[model samples]
Target: MDFKDYYETLGLERGATQDEVKRAYRKLARKFHPDVNKEPGAEEKFKEAGEAYEVLKDPEKRAAYDQLGANWQAGQDFRAPPDWNDGFEFSGGGYTEANEEDFSDFFETLFGRARAQGARQQSSRQFHAHGQDHYARITIDLKDAYEGATRTISLQAPEVDASGHVTLKTRSIRVNIPKGVTEGKHIRLAGQGTPGIGQGKPGDLYLEINFRDDGHYTAEGRDVYFDLPITPWEAAMGGKVKAPTPNGVVELKIPQNAHAGQKLRLKGRGIPGKSAGDLYAVLQIAVPPAKTDEDRKLYEQMARQMKFDPRAKLGV
Candidate 1:
């Protein structure tokens, strides 16, 4: 999809303050309003100005959009990076405009549809409205799931300054990660969202769980998987080899003539919970290079002595 530089659309610079953004948008809205200007593309320009203001006027949306960096130009081919808004906290519904369909695909791609109709419905109640719930994602180590952990995470939210410029307000929060918590799980923090209206209660903050990519390990549901490298001798003959688990390292038994890609399961060694998952150690054979004469002789002796043909079953 083509990148829509909101700032450029409204004839503003990247560093334009919130007030500048507002004034620029107002000027464009007047110049392009369909009733005032009967130009062929006036209506389209008006819609574009509205869309730009929709994002720029809101500090939270503007902060998230600014993350795309200042190097991007208008109408450039653009795709948002995966999880670009992962840690950003957003309040109210995604897009508050009444005419949602009028927004372009570029807008939809950045901010998804309203999470629920409750936010919009609640606006009708003028007496007391509940604060808008916020959502974000936090990444943790895989070991944090095995053993419950307390982590300190920093989050950024937009704050309007005295000059009406939007600035990011950063705060550090300590969170508890429950044991056996898998990916996609959410931890809720009460009264951590946008402030309420009148005597309404504050909203909540929901943090989605994600595990950092550790090269050695991967998880599926509760089950854990990792490659266990073994010497060629260990694969040829039964032996005990040290394997690393989330909890700790343990000795795993290799079967006689164990082939590469064989899996050895450790019962209840995965994430710790009422119904724990299993840990699979996928075996990979490691061959020693024949660098010296003795090593070469040893390999030559094995090749000559062993009459086994690995491809015999393939009829090659």
Candidate 2:
């Protein structure tokens, strides 16, 4: 799909405020209205301005568009990012009507079906109801919870079409998962849900948060846990060993005679937040297998040299 720069269409910079966008749309509409200007392409320009307003004037659409980033040029071949709206919750409430023939393909690509249906419903009905709120769960990376990240989420919901029939439609949007968000928490995106019936206000979208389960790490509350595998020599020699934490790896000093299943705590190294949680590394000592003669000889020598009897207490 070829992308359209709605900001460019209105002769405004990407940073234009809502008021600036509204003002620009009005000015452009008046200057290029076919009935007033009658200039070549004036009608096209007018429709373009309206389409731009249709997106920029709404916060949710504007945000979704902005997530595509600012580097795209107008008319550039574009494809919607996969899972672009994965974590976002969008409610539908505000919409402006335009003839399907007036808007370009790009406009329809973004807001065509919903806007057309809402407009048609508004004209046909006197009573209106608020749009329905939508909810979904999104699974994020553990690292994202530590440092924050943006995710694309796809949502399938029932949408009313121009024929007055409801059909399930899939849409995508991008959302920012804030730092330190834990599982079961929610992110809210206002006006990114189902469009209201008639002239009613749109409902909000709520996204439940879930974190990916990583093999190396497990989290409970803000605390993070990991298993630290070490050699038998390293466990008994009292040396510094590199331990893995969510933030990164750090040298952990193992005391002489450190036992299996012992936990070592690194303060404030877990999930980041006020009163941050700790990272716990549980130690597991692994003994080398005696495969070669030399290794077996060493084991025998140790068995004879050291007074060790692990099963002595079992009275075997």
Candidate 3:
């Protein structure tokens, strides 16, 4: 795939407003469309404009491209640096904003195939096409994945207006997050995407699931892992301890003399699945500080009564 300057293609500055980009694309598309104009390069020019409009028109793709900086020239030798998109919020949704398979190589390099986009656009062209399908991604608590949830999302769609002009409109709608849905998987919403042109039907919408960052645990596949803080005595004399899970708090028994970082597993406590993963509690021992006289006396007594030497292995 080649490189493209979406900003320049639309004849807009890098900082152009979403509205500005959309307006530019509408004007150019209408002007250069082969159906509307017979110029020799009309089709090619229209495609180039569409490709640019596709990226700049979306808030997500725009942000990702913006981070590439406004310094690189259009058509310049470009390759994604190792750290490119290091901190951007790409859903890896990886769909072209333009509907057709008519995008430039530059577009495909960054994002994968525009297959879905093409399908929707082409389907829209059918004489009685139904509504096109839309796609989105959202993050929620692992609990949301465990137990179904209801969430409201805001959608901004780039659409063709009554005058055959391209424009964007914003709307919000509520959706259900089904239980046991995993990351990178999609949830479909009937009649949610772009409305069909003519007497065509409306398209469906699909949303991919992602987990929000949690302080208590990190999820992988179907498993959940968490660090459990414990006192020194608990490590030396392990017993039942309280642990947190998506469902609720639960008691986990640990073996006596359990070492720090020892893992305790609770079967079927993780994500819901046929062979559900277990929840792991990795113990982190907390040493008491010598802030009180009693604490200092206990340490002094231990030092006097024990011959423990941490540096003995170093022959110090």
**Candidate 3 residues 1-316, lDDT tens each?**
3468887788988756777888999999999999999979999889999888778776556665666777788878888763454323332133544555796666666654234454545554555556556655566678888888898776554444555433545567797888777766778877776677678777777776777777888787888889988877777787888877789988877778877888888778888877777788888888889999999999999889977796999988
Better of 1 and 3 by TM-score: 1
RMSD of 3: 8.5
> What is the Å distance of residue 224 in model 1 from its true position?
1.8
Poorly placed runs, candidate 3 (over 4 Å): 1-54, 57-60, 63-131, 158-168, 197-201, 303-316
lDDT value for model 1: 0.84
lDDT of 1 by residue, 50-152 (tens): 9999899888889889888888888889898866776777775545544666688888888753234335535643445878777777888999999999988
Tell me, by lDDT, which candidate is best. Answer: 1
- Candidate 1 lDDT trough over 10 residues, lowest sum: 113-122
What TM-score, over all chains together, does every model reach? 0.78, 0.55, 0.62
The CA lDDT at 244 in model 3 is 78
Off by over 4 Å in 2: 1-129, 158-168
